[model samples]
Target: MTELDPVIHTPARLRIMTALNEALEDGDEIAFPALQKLLDMTAGNLTSHLAKLEDAGYIVVAKTFAGRKPVTRVAMTPAGRGAFRAYRTALLDILGGSR
Candidate 1:
């Protein structure tokens, strides 16, 4: 059996990775507010999840000012993208072999 990535396995974390994956593919960054809206997560929830990913070196968090307002943007790192792809492959392998 292929081992799944524990970091990306949780439902909420999975959703987080998925959102970041899509944005990464589009060569775009997701703002904290935007990610919260996309995932239907609260600000605190989003912040915690993002912190986990950031700690794992899977994503980069940048805080800058948009005019006078602070803006937080998150982007998946190359390592994060690779990990996600590997996780997907593991899932597919399990499903395929199960059938």
Candidate 2:
């Protein structure tokens, strides 16, 4: 198995993608605070990477009014999921996963 080339893989972006991929596994929407806490990232940091992901059509951001407050949720798109799976597989291949 071939590894994913670093040309399209960045550490920070990979972290963001991994987080979204984990969230999808549990059938729950990811909230900003929750994601921030999980990633231990600042708002600015997250925004920059999220912008890249959003621009790539890998994730969708939904905004809604929760009574008086606004709710923002991030969900991985199908394309995102597929890409993440491939990325994971490639990474494992690079690591030579135990058979």
Candidate 3:
């Protein structure tokens, strides 16, 4: 049996990673506000989970200015993509064994 990634196993974190994995498949970063709207998560809650994913080196958060307004963008790192793939494989393995 393969072990699931603890960092991404949490429901919120999983949702975050899943969203990033799908959204960023085009190789584009997602703005913080857009991500929040997509996930339907409050700012504080999203921030908390983002912190964990960032700490794990699974995502990169870039804060910059768009003209006069500050903008935050998030992207999944290469490591994050790999981790997410592994996590999915582990989940599939678990489910496959049940049948």
Candidate 4:
């Protein structure tokens, strides 16, 4: 069995990563509030998960302002995409054993 990445194995984080991977083009980003809405997560909860991903160097978070309104965006790094693909392959292999 392939080793699993603990950083992205959590349920919420997995969902966040998967959503980001699927919904946006590589190197593109989603607004924090948009991600929260898409994932149906509360601000604090989403922030917590994002912080973990950022610490792992799996994702990038940018904070700025748009017309004086604060804006936060998140995007996956290339390393993150690679990790996610590996994770998915491992999961498939593990599950494949059941067939």
Q: How far is 73's C-alpha from truth in model 2 (Å)?
A: 0.6
Candidate 3 TM-score over all chains jointly: 0.93
Q: Rate the local accuracy (lDDT) of all candidates.
A: 0.87, 0.78, 0.94, 0.92
Q: In candidate 2, how many clashes are counted? A: 0
lDDT (10s digit) by residue, model 2, range 1-99 = 586835228887788888788766644579877888889999889878887887787788778888999987888888878788787778778898842
Question: Over the full model, what C-alpha lDDT does candidate 3 score relative to the true structure?
Answer: 0.94
Q: What is the lDDT of residue 76 in candidate 1?
A: 91
- Mark the regions of model 1 whose C-alpha exceeds 4 Å error after superposition: 97-99
Candidate with the greatest TM-score versus the true structure: 4
Model 4 TM-score, all chains together: 0.94
Give the worst 10-residue stretch by lDDT in candidate 4. Answer: 90-99
lDDT of 3 by residue, 1-99 (tens): 779999999999999999999989735799999999999999999999999999999999999998999999999999999999889989989888541
Candidate 1: C-alpha RMSD to true structure equals: 2.2
RMSD of 2: 2.6
What TM-score against the true fold does each predicted structure earn? 0.90, 0.80, 0.93, 0.94
Off by over 4 Å in 3: 97-99
Q: At residue 5, what lDDT does model 4 achieve? A: 89
